[model samples]
Target: MHTHTSTVTSDSPLFDADGVLLHRHPDLWFEDGSVVCRAENTLFFVHMSQLARHSVCFRDMFSIGTHSTGTEASIKSESGVDEFPDYPVITLHDSAEDVGNLFTALYDGPNFGNNDPLDFRVVSGVLRLSTKYIIDGLREKAIVHLSQAWPTTLKGWDTREDTARSFEMKTGSSSGHMYPSPIAVINLAREVDAPTLLPSAFYDLCRYTYSQIFEPSEDDPLYVPLTYSNASPAASPGPHSGPMQLSLSDTQRLCLGKESALHAITGLIQSMSHSQSIRNSGVQLQSAFSFSHPLAQNPAHSAIIPHASNHHNPYHIHFSNHRRSSSNLICVSAAACRKDFSELVELATQHYVFDRERGFSDPLYVADELGQLKSAEFSNSDAPECKACARSLELWAARERERIWRMVPVWFRLSMDVGAERTASPPVVDIN
Candidate 1:
């Protein structure tokens, strides 16, 4: 229970509870009932009574002598001389540098080449002691060892025989690959913004399958067949079930008609002079069909005008006489309308004039118009006869207009004129 205090000075003896003198190192002292030690370049004070109670061996060793000579001799003469002391020696010095070097020798050891487990144990012991005593160098070295050890151990797993070996080689053996599942892989990719490792062909197949299942259209008869075969359709009927219940055969027929109409419209538009001319020509044809007879309305049976000049000039043609029957002008069927309109779009795209035409003359405008017509209100109704006829005429007109519009471009018009002139002039072929 004796309490003593001392200031660190040269040749101070650090003592334990039994009044045992531990070390006569350069640092250690007692003053005002407290013991002071220099560690990591700083002065630390502890009550002599508390130090004595907590470190009995330290006190006994200290009481023995100022240096470890007597203690070493006694330990050598006793059993198990090689055993480390149960308690470590605490030193006190006037300067932090002296104590730091002593601690480093004990902790790091004079030579790191000695791989003895005792050396490692000593290093660990010194780290705990340094922490308790606030020895900065020892604490820092301990932290370095702790930080470097785990990663080194993990990297060693690379040589192990396991399925994870390949993965380790590629991505490294961090906790990142410890337990990856399909869901986890997907989540990780999304979280890290990484690309999925799927192939391009897989992506294409997925897209094709998706389109086959979900591409919108009331006219598609295979809607049911394609839908029933796909998981997406079964899970979610989507927004257009009523109109999409068409038979597979019906869908095929509709697709063929649509394609044919598109080709026909495209060809006609390609032949037109100006977008306006196509519109005018369409109006004229509607009028002609409406006034003549039902027999005249057959698009397939009608003879096509071989030359542009032979056809009535669209600019001069008027629908005034057929105004009363304008709505009755049956031109083409509804099923063929979309195809025909697509052809007009192609023509208009080719003949685009940046400034002359307004909104309705544009290809986008024609596409919008066709899009509106194909919506539920038009295509899903029961008026197939009237709807089909009206759609066909509109399709043809739109195509003609687009073709003419495309022709208005300076480059296209010039090319056409040159081709025409060349055709008019007979080729000079020399036979050898």
Candidate 2:
């Protein structure tokens, strides 16, 4: 004898038999809709035609006999009795907010042209559902929106940094106010398998201290909502209702990436201190700026500076015995220019770039600070002469920053083509 297994479907209106009230979405609930979707405590009454139009998953589900109005498909209370006006109900495993955002994108055609704080919320929520339901158009749109905020190019990163600085200067507020928390971005990137977003996201997350990464405070931007709809009340404990935690794999990625960033900081200092050819000019080295390098103080530090005839090193500024040409800007008072470069490098080391207490892990910020040495405020009163050498220094710093930016994906161990603007699956991170 063959035994039949009957599946109970929960599709009741308003409330289930368990007294669990399902809140109907204020904006998404259409009275004349053909289907109802229950996501946790929320209910969305939407048209099946529209769902099938945007989502292949829904269309496939409908193509099967699952939407039938047979007794097996009828609404069943907790007690297994049929009830309610017969509308086909589908239960979504995703959060109600995500479902709502997905529908909003599908119906309204992805309008994300706002500078609000909740922009990440809408993009992330919609992206999750769109990717899940195989909505290619919506998924691509969401990726574009995400890539704009957390861009792939070095120029885009520079623009984003400049905009944050501008916002900070104009409003006298923390630059953190202008962008979403990178921790949240990292989480979203992993959740949606968007590997292209990982490099910038991981680099941005390194801006926070070691403590801040693991133990974000109450005011931390990580707690910001991933989706905020003015039309709907707050969601209960759900996917995006609270701050998201990184998986052990992601945490390992972050910790290792942060260490690499610190090493890059040392690399910036070296590039500023050593990697320049005073160029066809006679610049004599001076002992004006001979402070021990911050890295040299560490016990595990390597001898990055070797003993050479008054030449470039972290501890001393040495130059070749080439004759100075009075006509050349860098060659004119070359010793003074060398001293000025050394002094500015020391100033940047102690106050701006390499200070560990300040927790400055941002190589781009370090590069920008190093580049700012061209100004009279940083250099000697002889702005014309000092600026010539400072310009070379600035160029070197810019190049170092670009190099570091390119290495970000490698540092994070993300298997992404950093040169390309496309998504990939999250790499299988090995915590072991």
Candidate 3:
């Protein structure tokens, strides 16, 4: 006849038939008359009679100790076994299997006395042991603590050189050779969300890096200008030589349209002046007394024609002269000089139809005419247009004279050669 064996899964603690707690390996159990255990990574089975003497217990198979005549006294006596040497202490009132489960839970949970020194030592020791056993969780926890404690403990190794060496020593050759620099440490802090240490380390690293990269030399020009200005004479050539001298082409390239033309003219005038061979030529002022208006034959040089009393004269009267033909002679007041000069320059530059048709032979004649009018005396009563035109011409002449003067050397010998002469007579006026 064949016999059938049944298996039962129970939440109750595992125990021997006599009800004594049994300390079995994780993959072992004791139920009814069977002893089931794993050894050397393999399962094995035996009867209670075949079990080792040390592996068996009597009196309430789940109990830590045997029940005696005085049960309370025996329980009390056994309870104190935890304080005795060479006695195994029971942490939980359950079978050895339940106790094993509880130990694993405590090891994995936060209730493992996280703040205690002894707990830390135990955890570290377990982690070290786990590395040999290839326990993933324990090894990972060890790494986390090591990385977290680095900033606080690695004080002397805050510099790049020191940090690199320390990291190498801690992790060993294979893993340690890839140690981070101080800058990398700061970056790691940022990655790991260490708020307090990250910013401080980051700033320090930045400053150090900048200092290394941009260290100033003793002879650097920028340093002299920025540093020793007060201690030294102001005229001393700063470490910098001088303002950079630009070429004409470069200046022209940088200049705006009208500004470029102006700079070109200024440079030309400066060059001419610097050459020193150029003479200081004089400009001629036209003789106002001899000037004749083209519009009328034998026109009066000075005359004042009265206007109607009812009409208001916009200009104030200066000196008015009545000479020959009833001509009104007027000179611009100083106040109206600016407006007249502006208008005359505009009129002089304009290409009038009459001037183009006539094919004017003498460009100098127009300039002379403008110059003559500019010298004409005028009161405030004179027409603003005439006064404005005269004043504008005077300003134009002054500016032109200045421009011409800039092209001449400040001092030059007057030579009789080339039609130039030193005469006892007053200087001849030449307005070219």
Best-fitting candidate, scored by TM-score: 2
Better of 2 and 3 by lDDT: 2
lDDT (10s digit) by residue, model 2, range 148-262 = 7689876667667667778889988777777777766776666666777778888888878765666656665445444523222221123345445567887888888888888
Model 3 Cα lDDT, one tens digit per residue, 287-390:
12213221122333112222213322211121122132223323323235434444434554453323433322222123334444454534532644443334
RMSD of 3: 39.9
TM-score of every prediction relative to native: 0.17, 0.73, 0.16
Which 10 successive residues of model 2 have the least lDDT summed?
317-326
Local distance difference test values of all predictions, in order: 0.31, 0.61, 0.29
Question: Which candidate wins on lDDT?
Answer: 2
**For candidate 1, lDDT tens digit of each residue in 1-432?**
323223334344443333334443232322332333434234333344544343443344345534332342221112223111222223442234334343445433533212122233333334334444444554455434422211112111122213334545776653223221112122221222222211111111121122332463433211332332111221213344431322343234334433333443344444332222112244333422233332224344232212122222221112232232455654334234434445544545554432112211223233333323333344555533344334334443433333333332221112232223111112121110
lDDT score for candidate 2 against the true structure: 0.61
- Candidate 2's displacement at residue 292, Å, is 21
Ranking by TM-score: 2, 1, 3
